[model samples]
Target: MPIEILMPALSPTMEEGTLAKWLVKEGDTVQSGDLLAEIETDKATMEFEAVDEGVIGKITVAEGTEGVKVNDVIAILLADGETADDIGGADAKPAPASSNAAPAEPSEATEPAAGYGRSGSAAQEDKPAAPAAGSKNGERIFASPLARRIAADKGLDLANITGSGPRGRIVKADVENVTAQPATAKAEAAAPAAKADAPKGSAMATGPSTDVILKTYEGRPFEEVKLDGMRKTVAARLTEAKQTVPHFYLRRDIQLDALMKFRSQLNTQLEARGVKLSVNDFIIKACALALQQVPEANAVWANDRTLRFEKSDVAVAVAIEGGLFTPVLKDAEMKSLSALSSEMKDLASRARDRKLAPHEYQGGSFAISNLGMFGIDNFDAIINPPHSAILAVGAGVKKPIVGKDGELSVGMVMSVTLSVDHRVIDGALGANLLAAIKDNLENPMTMLA
Candidate 1:
């Protein structure tokens, strides 16, 4: 039987994508790891690869096809003895419903290309026997290569683990979620708990339908624009954030006279090396160090618990054409100002081009959304989930300030708002975190120390 090549989910959030281009045509011979197609997910355009050696028997979906759901059979590959005739009589299998399964692990026969990011490994048991390629009933065990390896290493039986992948094919997540305990016992415990914890009904109200909105604006001169994948994902995630996440805002103003002066001197000295730094770079350093100063604030909200981190991974919001990307800077506190600036530039450039990999923009304990460059005064940012808080920075302007001697003086001041997730951080902790950020920014030279 010809192997079905389903549309791969490039990112965890991707539900559907554009089949941008097909690299191989029908009747073309493809070896394992050969480039198959370019899939444009909600985040970026990534190349999909072949997992098995075969000849391309058929192409089900056309190039430039939009809204092609994940797990939909995009193409078919015929093994050594098979040909295109095999596809016609093949029994069509059902696709899974919006699967969250991970990609197969790389093997000796083929190495995964540079762009696709793999998910992290979970807890596992001691080594077990490798599962057979076929099940007891003689049906082929349809599991990802990575899933099979994990199952074997963890001493798990493929027959015991139910797959949540396309056509009941076992993927990485299905294998990782299983524990060392007996499958029956785990399933029994999980079923009742799942039933007890299930929400009674949909608490979220649906917005007015499209027809209703269009009818309401009947006879109006307007163009109905279509929402792209990036825009759609942004809308859904931000809507979920506002509705479900408990957010509290804390605002503060900091004098930036000393910082600006210090920055000028550093830029002048570093001119030969072409290492000029932006105020945003300093802000990144300040927030990263602040997370260290007030360690309690450096955390994320896991479903049932809080995940505290040892290093400060900061996500910086970069606005692009259709939407935005928050490329994360891992271990930001340890990086020098010049290094942070360079990395931010590269990330922002790639983000605008939609070339960032999943890992480049995915995880972070905190995020910074600065509209200061846009000349905005101040605004509260919606917390990007799992993140404990986000710092919203605004423009700096000259303001009158009373000195310790009671004399009025003009100083460059900037307004900032820290939007904290109450689940991971409290009011006092957020305040302290903001205070630390302010202290670092105001006495900018101390950042060097």
Candidate 2:
């Protein structure tokens, strides 16, 4: 039997996905571990792998087709020589499977996404730049057959005529309403009588050459290519996350002077053992240990329950070319510092290049969005959903602190803010969690222990 390849839900918040690219196309033979396609989930344009060995029969979903719901069939894997039409029924509909889903009613939490039922349009502002002159036709504009007939009957060239369809394909109404005069006017079109009344330089003034002039000494023109799939996904998701997550800021400055000294001594001693410790790695270990101490804050906001995850899947937010992605360091509480650092290095490198598989980028019990390297003083982060809170780390700065002897001493202090989902955790609970993390960071020995 042919297997239906459903769009795998990458994140819990991912209700639908856009088919970014197909690593394997129709008639291609794929092994069980082969890459099948790249899916643009809410968070990342992650590589989806094949789970079953078979010949790729039909591609139910085309790349760039967005708003395809979860579990919706995007492709088919069949036995040798089977065609796609033979597997998935010929009656199958396209992206945004036909459903009785009504327009979503606005509520306090949902009003932000009004008119977008599950079947609503995928964010199109995130689409790649419009094709360069003479590029291949992207999603053909949607037009009714009647409209096509009307355009044909009217001798209206669809090419010159602009489309008013969903993706900008010419429709019947568009053909009827265009300002182009009839071909009969071609005789009188450029006649002197017509030219006398025409506004001087009107067409030239509104012409398209003026946007950005790029001409070479040799007379070659230049056109800049656009943001790739990874970049577009990064922009849309991060923007939506920051805007909709209802963020409230919290900042705590910590004395990291002792912590830094300890790390310096620690990295030197372990240098020969191939375990070099950075202060941030130590901070991650500290955060992991602290999470174990206060598991309540590690819960996700569910319908009626604050869902507490049992594992310590620590999502370390890493930055890449166009945006940021957080590939989780799973079971951080169980891994040694070296193990954690090694795993993080491998994942971070791949994530930055958009080379990570869906599994590597998915699932986290908690999150850490660190901007310490960029020298950001402090910032609040959105809770990458299904994970209740995210810890934002700022740069460590030298500041005066009261010594045990009541004398002023210079110390290194790093600021951190934990952005918690109000529905999942309370403010006091988040504060306690931050205090525990601070303690672990202050006592470097405990993080190692």
Which candidate should be chosen as best, given lDDT against the real structure? 1
Candidate 2: segments with Cα more than 4 A from true spot: 1-247
Tens-place lDDT per residue, model 1, 392-447, is 99999999999999999999999999999998899999999999999999999889
TM-scores, in order shown?
A: 0.77, 0.58
> What does the lDDT come to for candidate 2?
0.66
For 1-449, candidate 2 gives per-residue lDDT tens digits of 46667676665445567898999888899988898988886556777888778887778788999877665557767766565545534224334524886533222121111111111112211111112111113222333334444554565444455656544544445766765548775345336334534432332223354444343223666556665545555555555556555555567998887788888887888899888877768777877887789988767765557678776788888887667778888788899888888888888888876667667877776789888889999997877766777889999998888988999988889989988777777788878888988998888777766
List ranges where model 1 is wrong by over 4 Å. 91-205
What lDDT score belongs to each candidate, Candidate 1 first? 0.80, 0.66
Residue pairs that clash (backbone atoms under 3 angstroms), model 2: 141-169
Q: What TM-score would candidate 1 get against the native?
A: 0.77
Top candidate, metric TM-score = 1
